[model samples]
Target: MTSVPMIDEILAEFLQSGLGIHVGTRNEQLLPAGCRATAIKVEDDGRHVVVFVPKSAAPAVFENLRTNGRIAVSMARPADDRAAQVKGLMMFSWDANPDEEALARAQWAGFLAQLDGIGLPGIATSSWRVFPCRAVRVKVTAVFNQTPGPDAGAALP
Candidate 1:
């Protein structure tokens, strides 16, 4: 018999539950530019690659990503089942173009508004942009349990 690593196990659970949050941060400042997104998909080859849609929330979500160079994310699992835990990781921006993608999604207006609160300072407030999601390799840093109880037992695969 063989055993699958916890990362592999968690990824399986993530696929079952198609919802998660994609977080991005600044490289220099290291300040968290809060951004929420839906787990669109995940690809695991050598490393895990998680794709998300930041549906018209904040432009900084994408801008900060450009300046910062990387991002992180957390995804929730089933409510009752406690077999798995929330997955978190710092994702590197391999290739991304906000302007091009934003045009496609048509959520440019909404994303710009969200960035206003962030106060990019020197950065100018631009129209909504769609980040068509150029995939990146995500190194799974940690996986921790949300609740600890008798229910914290193995779940069905």
Candidate 2:
């Protein structure tokens, strides 16, 4: 099979920079669920993107994915107000492996640092429950530049 990147290098770099990540889903009844993302990875193939959030933190998201499969993830660097969004169908949702957990920890730390750099400090995360995570994998159907600008909402190539 031929392989193509779901996200190019620039977008990938931006996503890896400890931005604020949020994931979205809807149940069969069209009820929306959202939760902070704990970690993210774009596979080497570049077509599969995996996002992590603790199961305890987002049971509704997982349940929604299982039944509805539609998924959308938004990422942003709030200090600069740059943002992007990806929408796709859920490929799978699973318990995070050991390596995935480590990735989550690293990204969460980076996010904390970013918050501090923006002069916001001591943000409480205890309620986030970002551990013993669940990973949701999505096959990218579309990506958009969500940053506010003249070209905001443009579809990324």
Candidate 3:
């Protein structure tokens, strides 16, 4: 099994620190969507992650996430290429709070709209709360080495 850190504690740290995750789809048939976003919001109790994406791409992105239930997310410094990307199966959970959900929808719309002007293909930037499923499974790889890195080689320590 491939693993590189998907524990709740690690995810919580990422969320609290406001990390940037490169959200991509697992849809192999099409080119992956490469959009940047911060872990803007996390559930108060730690059940979900609120990510801000281009409003325009929200529908397709959410739809893809909903249908596929798989995502590759990573956090890296603004200028650093060395980062960790973990594949976590995601699901959309409805927020009982109408205002919050509405805000999410609005953000999604705005993010999606931005993509229209840009000629390049990319995912939309709507903000949605990501309720990741249980039973986390991750795929990990280390560059420049046949052996895994210090962090990549072991289970949650």
Model 1 per-residue lDDT tens digits across residues 1-157: 4434435645554443533344655546676676655343344431354444444657666676656446555444333323333333445543345553543233333333334435543232333222445443455444444335755433323
Best by lDDT: 2
- Pick out the ten consecutive residues of candidate 2 with the lowest summed lDDT: 122-131
TM-score of each: 0.47, 0.91, 0.44
- Choose 1 or 3, whichever is better by TM-score: 1
Candidate 3 runs further than 4 Å off: 1-11, 28-30, 40-48, 79-82, 93-157
Instruction: Name every residue pair that clashes in candidate 1.
Output: 27-68, 101-130, 102-129, 102-130, 108-128, 108-129, 109-128
Candidates by TM-score, descending order? 2, 1, 3
Per-residue error at 115 for model 1, in Å?
27
Model 2 over residues 1-157: C-alpha lDDT tens digits? 7777879887888887777899998998898999888878887776778988777765788888888789999998857879999899888878999988988888888888888888878784555577888888899889999998899889986
In Å, residue 51's CA in model 3 sits off its true spot by 3.2
- Mind giving the per-residue lDDT tens digits that candidate 3 earns over 1-157? 5333333565455433533445676454664655454333444433445454444344555566666656655554322223445445565533324555454444434434434444423553333443221112223221111123566523332
Ranking by lDDT: 2, 1, 3
Give the Å error, residue 97, model 3. 6.9
